[model samples]
Target: METIIREDTPKTPYVKLDGEKGVVEIKGRSIPENSVEFYKPLIDWIDEYGDDPKDNTIINIQLEYFNTSSSKCILDIFKKLELLFKKGFKVQVNWYYEEDDEDMFEAGEDYQSIINLPFKMIEMEE
Candidate 1:
């Protein structure tokens, strides 16, 4: 599968999905004007990746901020990972947050509560 790579902009996050390495990362602020357009292809890519079934799939999400639409997209991504886990793939999520960002840390914790896959809330010095 081809990787998804998009540099971060003021309104969107950076997406780097390396199918070969089984590491997918989405970092930066995500408040895209067209959330559906920005996330559709990513959702498709994850669907394809889930089919082939990698041994380990690690998704790292470090978002400084996001809008409601983007939050929905993130939930969609988590659902995809849940599906992969159900199919017997080793899946993990590392949700990175800045040291002093309580809201971001809590958001990660909230996501962890909703999803069945293993999730790690990581604190990064910013």
Candidate 2:
């Protein structure tokens, strides 16, 4: 599958979904006017990628901040990943939060608790 890349904007995150490499990355702020619309293609791409996913899939999430609507969209992405994990493919999510950012850390923990996929909370220097 072709790689999907979206540059980060003031109100959206940078996204790179490489099916061939089995790597996904999302970074920056995500408070789009229409969260669902902004993330629909991404979710759809994951669905398509699921048909013939790589043996090992990794998603790196490094968001500085996100609004409530974006949070739901993020969860949808995780749910999609959860399905892939259940199918027996090796999947992991690396959630990166800036040092001293308690809220971000807790957000990662929240997603970790809800999703069955393995999650690694990474602390990054501010």
Largest TM-score belongs to which candidate?
A: 2
Residues 1-126, model 2: lDDT tens digits:
999999999999999999999999999999998999999999999999999999999999999999999999999999998999998999999999999999999999999888899999999997
- Highest lDDT scorer: 2
Please give the RMSD of candidate 2 to the true structure: 0.5
Cα lDDT tens digits for candidate 1, 32-94 = 888999998999899889889679999999899899889889999999989999988899999
Model 1 misplacement above 4 A: none
Q: CA RMSD for every model?
A: 0.9, 0.5
Runs with alpha carbons beyond 4 Å of true place in candidate 2: none
